[model samples]
Target: MSDSENPVDIFRGFLQVLKSFQILIILTALTGLALLVTNGMIDGDWGRLSGGWANVKIFLSESLPLDWQVIEARSYPVCEQEIEFFCSTAYIGMLETIKIAFVATVFGFIGAILLSSLAARNLSPTWLSILVRIILSALRSLPSLIWAILFVIVVGLGPLAGVLAMTFYTIGYLGKLQYEAIEGMESAPLEASRATGLSHPEIFTNVVIPQTGNHLLSQMMFMFEYNVRHGTVIGIVGAGGIGYFINNYLKLFMYSRVFSLLIIIFVVVVIIDLLSMAIRSFVNDQGDVRRPSWFTVLLPAKNAVEIHHGSAGEEES
Candidate 1:
């Protein structure tokens, strides 16, 4: 049959047309959504865009008579002294930021572990799981920045506010991640554990924890890294961290000091990211149940259970 008269060819052409039409519809929908979300940003005044570009050009121009130059010229004579002060203050502020993130992550992870145990569908009772899921969903609905603002207002201010905000937010975030990890675990091992007449706690302490340990640790490390970055942002609202110094410098137009402090923050965040990567890689390489010695010590029974499971699998193979 001629191609145009062929039924298969006609059907194929129809499908191609339908695919293109579907794509066009999707693109149109996305474009409308973008416009709605941006609230006229995309189609705003051309004059404002021109002015913004002009300001950006002025910022980049070395010959511009900027206020920063005046400040630098005045401080040139005492540049060495200024460096010392910047270093000391920035160091202290960064340390405080790290402390806040660390404390928040530790407390949050602990809370997440507990809550996630009750939230996992396979491990927890239906009512308890549903309740925990609802609580977690509510917590996760708000951004960390919003939580920080509320805590700052309630607790007054300082690292305490930052810590509390990070803690609550992290619990929600980590709990969701961990319970997902638990639910995503291999059903074979869990079923085997259940068939052994083990109690719920025993199954969780053995099969659940061991099977998902790597995922839990990896996610926790990521959360800690995320909290470090978030801690700085929350400090802008007087929650007290390196961001406090950043805000102070920006307000005072101390661009040089601000630049230096930004570098410090960058270095700290990069170091944390690298450390997390290394630890995650190490855990992944060391086998499924591999974990830190301290973790093994804390849950010797879990480790033994994992070993038993491993041997059982080998025997089946």
Candidate 2:
């Protein structure tokens, strides 16, 4: 009859809190099996998949006919001299890739602003948050490559389709991140700004934005970096840029060129990541200098380890 009479009682209570159900597990397994059967991504040739992992024999072997020798061929663009010569000509397409990514980022940033505002748990009521969450989730559910493919058919094959896809895709992604940033924000500056009789828009732009500025910039940079990497791949579906070149080489079975393209992509993505990291670090450090920590105003020491609320003005409640 004492609390220690039955440990099983506590175990049952824990199970009740979890809403433990065998039916959910069974449903998950069933759904997984159905997806495995239907999705071509799961139709992986396990034996060759292991072989492919080692980078061998990806395509079926074939012999070219003697008539192929009659056609002229361009030499591989290599060497410092060739790089200098062709970098301008050859990389015009890559510049187009950069442009595509740039346009996409701008549109994506705008869309993210709107969607994230609505998605903000603090700014939005329960129903609005739920609705926008579902919409953002739907935007994020599809692969951007697939979106590019669909758009290529609708808009014709070019960077426009890729840009559009990246924009739409990033809206969902950045919206989710930015909304979480808004949710996790401290309320002190916000309250102070509101108490001054600032409008809601003014409070958001000045107080909240300054508080989260560093994180927001870092997130935006990360989104741009992510788009660059994905932008490299989407061209395979005829969206535009180097991916299209890669697909062309792939069609011709020019594995050497494809390998070269892969190398280029690797270098570019690494450079992009490094640049983003450096910029984010520098910007964050600088931002901290510009904004005084609203939470640390009453700290006893310069490097205070803890925030203790000594008055009603400090703590929320």
Best by lDDT: 1
Candidate 1, 14: how far from true, in Å?
A: 7.6
Give each model's whole-structure lDDT.
Answer: 0.81, 0.73
Model 1 steric clash pairs: none
Using TM-score as the measure, the top candidate is: 1
**197-240 per-residue lDDT for model 1 (tens digits):** 99887888888887887798889888988888887789899988
Q: For residues 49-143, what per-residue lDDT tens digits would candidate 2 score against the true structure?
A: 57675454433222222122112232444334433434432264456677788788889988887788778877767899899999999988888
| TM-score of each candidate structure, all chains considered together | 0.70, 0.64
Clashing pairs in 2: none
Instruction: Write down the RMSD of candidate 1 (Cα, Å).
Output: 11.7
Candidate 1 lDDT at 218 equals 85
| Native-referenced Cα lDDT, model 1 | 0.81
